[model samples]
Target: MSKLDALPHGPEFRFVDELVSLEPGKQALGRYLVKGDEAFLVGHFPGNPLMPGVILIEAIAQLGGVVAQSDPEIAALKNLLLTGVRGAKILGAAVPGELLEIEATVEGRLGGMIQVSGRVSTAGRELATAKIMLSGEE
Candidate 1:
């Protein structure tokens, strides 16, 4: 199993496939492969399947969480929850078999919460972008 697979999220819900690179409390880059046979693809569309925007946001958040958790202080807490999202926009649709590249940058931290902004893209095409807040738990 990959490092991302070891996160708190289960297999069915884990959106992060690989941690390509990371800089604690600064930034992170990751990728996820959209397997055509994924459960979400079965009913997302009948004749045509498309990755849902929510999933894209989740992927972004998961990537951001990995970045935040890279900090020794946050990792020691052992839990991270997405608390808020803002300025989210989907610019394109992601299809199965494509590799989704996710990137996140830390904006600041508020007590136990880490704020970040992220973007998702495939093959150099923008798919989505959002600002998210994650709270760490002890």
Candidate 2:
């Protein structure tokens, strides 16, 4: 199974399209394609649809969750959730037809909480970056 299988999101909510590389607990790289048919795009900007910053953040967090759950050294936690986000910056925007490259790395861990740093980029241009915290039942 793909490392992304560790994530609990359904098809509609899951953002990462493919896991390009993974280092179990250490890090992961993934990709997503903006298809323009997403429900949120309908009202995101009628004529000029753009992916929301919040969704971008969610994508990062999802990848983070995948990284956290794949750690062989730690017991997998149940029901992993994105509990916090810090220093989130949206430097650019993504539109339909753009492919997003996402990268996340495990920064540290405390009990059932995992801290991750992540970024979203496409065509060598970074669109967003953030440090996110994920918690799961111990």
- Per-residue error for 34 in candidate 1, Å, reads 0.7
What is the per-residue lDDT of model 2 for residues 1-138, given as tens digits with 9 covering 90 to 100? 877776788888989999999999999999999999999999999999999999999999999988888888898999899999999999999999999999999999999999999999999999999999999988
lDDT for model 2, please.
0.94
Kindly provide the TM-score of model 1 when superposed on the true structure, using C-alpha atoms. Answer: 0.91
lDDT of each: 0.86, 0.94
Residue pairs with backbone atoms closer than 3 Å in model 1 (clashes): none
> Which parts of model 1 have CA positions greater than 4 angstroms off?
1-6, 73-75
TM-scores of the candidates in the order shown? 0.91, 0.97
RMSD of 2: 0.7
Model 2 clashes, total count: 0
Error of 1 at 100 (Å): 0.7
- Stretches of candidate 2 off by over 4 Å are none
User: Model 1, range 25-111, lDDT digits (tens) per residue?
Assistant: 689899999998889888999779999998999998888887776675555345678889999998999998999999999899877
Highest TM-score model number: 2
